[model samples]
Target: MKFTFFTALILLFAPLTSYSLSQISNPNYDPELAEKLGADDYGMKSYILVILKTGENTSINKEMRSNAFVGHMKNINKLVDQKKLIVAGPFGKNNNDFRGIFILDVSSIDEANLLLETDPAIKEKYLKAELYPWYGSAALSEYLESSDKIWKVNP
Candidate 1:
């Protein structure tokens, strides 16, 4: 019984110990980068506002839009893995002003732009993405403190 309990405790704490050791050894190990890349994969969320152009709008049929949404959904997992996008969805009825929004977990506005460049809709002129720096509620403000990563408000 004692042996089994000791083994279980070691197993439970082994990862924590390793993480602590890594942090100690690499004093510059960025908490933000770690959070972005670690196994837990927790990342700061920021909204990407998309505006659809009026004149050259690529409004395909409803069926095609549905199919495209499905295809976009399929590629989302890869985006998350790359820490480019976290969550994305179209706005509801009352919020039709913008075309859509993508919540991303990138490190900078430049990174966000790169990610936006990958979208077929944006590439094809169906939409254009403008990133905005988001400061979440009081409980989640730490993630938004990185000046280099945060987007600037447009005048």
Candidate 2:
């Protein structure tokens, strides 16, 4: 069979393309860690992601805002210590209507909702939690372990 120039080019690159794809799978794959991380065939696991948005009750009083936020951060620290909260951060410079988000390592959205309720910001109605079912890499669970080497935030 005669092949066109483009077809010949594709044939030449096909093996290299497949080789590049297979390289993504590590040679030192860990089966135990894969199972423990809830990784599926795609190496992704379900998570409850909570978006912290400004509630209907906007803060006019600076003291109340500071108090609630302080408590909210303390609540986040508590969850981190428990290893229930995987990732938390603000969406600054992204856009309006979004303050921050929390990616919980909990098993269910109900658990994540209850955990968010402990935040003073959510409890006081200063910040509302919008929970969503999300799927992300199982390796995301390792962030905190290597975070200490990054830098410390002095309060």
Candidate 2 residue-wise lDDT, 30-123, digit = tens: 8888898888867888899988888877769999989998998899889999988899998886556788999998778888888887888888
lDDT of each: 0.55, 0.87
Candidate 1 — worst ten consecutive residues by lDDT sum?
A: 136-145
lDDT for each residue of candidate 1 in 16-131, tens digit (9 for 90 to 100):
99997776344554676555443232333444433333224567677755665455555555676664555555655554456556666554677778876676556555566667
Residue pairs with colliding backbones in model 1 are none
* Regions of model 2 farther than 4 Å from truth: 1-26
Off by over 4 Å in 1: 1-55, 59-71, 137-155
Clashes of each: 0, 0
